[model samples]
Target: MSNTIYKNGIFGPNEWAVLEDEADLPESGKVLVSPDRFLALEGSAPEGVELGVVIRAGEKAERLVAHLAKLPMVAIDFPKFSDGRGYSSARLLREKFGYKGELRAIGDVLIDQIPFMIRCGIGSFEISHAPTRRALEEDRLNEVPIYLQPVGRDGEVPLGTRPWARRRVA
Candidate 1:
């Protein structure tokens, strides 16, 4: 079952669907992973193999950016129920690294964290298989209206953070 955390009144994941080694990965399509297991090989990632990383909080997120900048996608890990590291990490990945690809939540994905995850720049989520009633309650939290503002404002000033704030989405 997936676990979720609250961020800015919304719920999100602790980690994501990560494959351990190359054998655990498929030849094509998207493959999830954690930072610790990522093999630093330029062009080693097979064609059509969209590798992802499951960051265990925002601790080394900034440092990993230069390395992750080469990848296609990354997922943040939340560990425990109260862990907010993934939330902060997601924000940095988007604002600092300028990751323009997909950011998804894989582990402990409850309902309430969805909205905040989106604000933090997460575009996809892996909902749990056996969600309890608590999951439903949390999910409703994200259902509220979200103003056009990404999570942290460059970790300093919060202003015009939306990627499309300057354009019209019709």
Candidate 2:
């Protein structure tokens, strides 16, 4: 019943602990905090504790713009498969704000949407779906090789002179 954390092209353990609003911060560990808590803490957690923010649905990623440089990780909640706002948030964080740290997606992460998520700059995923977990564990995900829109990530080649049509180089 453990959740699988897929990162850097491999499925492994989740190292960061998610903290509730009322929970006491650990003295030394990686912790994911809500936006309000993150703001309240002002990006300052206990010594030896790495701070990360979980940007939930309906929350704007811009709120974290000032603190992006200090954050080692940022997890965007999917909440549901149909909610695509996290994609835009990821893109903005990577492309606009230039957040080079680990961008993670949590909840409702499906195999079909993983490729697209990667394109949007999500480097890790906290996956709970059994089928998706199996796909990652087996290294057999169904994905489209070609992409029409450019996401500004490396290894994406333009298909032709159109400038919009592109394909992933991998």
Candidate 3:
């Protein structure tokens, strides 16, 4: 992915390095490890490296609850555009677990799903899709103004008198 990340409404170099399961850990840097690796190194990761975890679609979000505070970033894998499990994982990490760190969506991220992903509390995206990346870069996403579901996020106002219908604050 060339260390390029779209985050906080800007495209910038990604500071976190993703580590392969068989790779050796670097002494100093921000690193994102797989769920299993994260669990194994939970209390014993190298002190110089800031740790993060990438949760796959099938992994349980609760597995990282106790370590949320120490984690600066948590990435949920979409795997495919049809897989909606990452959305729920992001919501659980943000709302239920009270995770205030960066929630990143990785793998199979598409332009059409950006707005919905934001509503679900995913703040960053690691996009590999060429069209999606182009849309993001050009700021030409066709976003829906109204939301049919209440995601319990701040700055969302109810549309008319219907509590279920909401719009994001500009």
From the highest lDDT down, the ranking of the candidates is 2, 3, 1
Please, what is the whole-model Cα lDDT of each candidate in the order they appear? 0.61, 0.86, 0.85
Look at candidate 3 and give me any clashing residue pairs.
Answer: none
Alpha-carbon lDDT of model 3: 0.85
Superposed on all Cα atoms, the candidates' RMSDs to the truth, in angstroms, are 7.9, 2.5, 2.5
Q: Which stretches of candidate 2 lie over 4 Å from their true place?
A: 1-3, 152-154, 157-165
- The lDDT leader among the candidates is 2
* C-alpha root-mean-square deviation, candidate 3: 2.5
TM-score of 3: 0.87
| Candidate 1 C-alpha lDDT tens digits along 48-149 | 677676676544776566676676677776565577778888887888778887777666765566666776788766555355335654454434343454
By TM-score, how accurate is candidate 1? Answer: 0.61
Q: Name the runs in model 1 displaced over 4 angstroms.
A: 1-17, 21-25, 67-69, 129-170
Worst 10-residue stretch by lDDT in candidate 3?
Answer: 158-167
> Lowest-lDDT window of 10 residues in candidate 1?
149-158
